[model samples]
Target: MAKAKSLKAGDKVEWETSQGKTTGTVKKKLTSPTKIKSHKVAATKENPEYLVETEKSKKLAAHKPDALKKK
Candidate 1:
């Protein structure tokens, strides 16, 4: 299995997209239930999620640590 990435705010990361891979910067770590982009996120301290902003579009999205690769 692939190792889980330890990401932090301001860290550069990349994830898969329909167009291909997109790069972004981590905005924050979500450790509690919250809503993002009108979608409900079920993140917890033990299973946290990350909020990232795309470099090109500057769009915000949430993703799991395993889904992100440090750039």
Candidate 2:
């Protein structure tokens, strides 16, 4: 598997979802994996995480660093 990403709050990012390409802001960084929309996220202290809220939908989610791109 590829390495996870490191992100900070207030970062702009893009991600692919059922709704298509979506943009959002990083809300929080998680040290451990958490459940978002029934999906299990694998997060660790070394890799860390970012909890993002979708710009259009206003939905909150957790995503791996590799799953997101800085924009």
Candidate 3:
């Protein structure tokens, strides 16, 4: 098993999407539950959400830390 990473803003990460493996930069770290880009996300307790901006399109989306991979 692998350990999870605590990502911060500006960190580079990759995630799997419909478009394949997409790379992005961390834009924001959510401390409280919030909605991002119409996606209802919970950032609390054991799960926290991160706002990531895609490197290619510069699109911002909210995702769980587990969805991100350090690059």
Q: Per-residue alpha-carbon lDDT of model 2 for 1-71, expressed as tens digits? A: 22336667898889888868889999989988788879887888887778999998889988878888888
Provide the lDDT at 8 for model 1.
83
TM-score per candidate, in order? 0.90, 0.74, 0.82
Off by over 4 Å in 3: 1-4
Query: Candidate 2: TM-score?
Result: 0.74
Instruction: Give stretches of model 2 more than 4 Å off.
Output: 1-4, 35-40
- Model 3, range 1-71, lDDT digits (tens) per residue? 22227888998888899979998898878878887668777788477788899998989888887888888
User: Model 3: how far is 3 from its true place, Å?
Assistant: 6.4
Q: Pick the candidate with the highest lDDT.
A: 1
Per-candidate total of colliding backbone pairs: 0, 0, 0
Model 1 compared with the native: what TM-score?
Answer: 0.90
Q: Total clashes, candidate 1?
A: 0
**lDDT by residue for model 1 (1-71), tens:** 23337788998888888999999999999999999878999999999999999999999998999888887
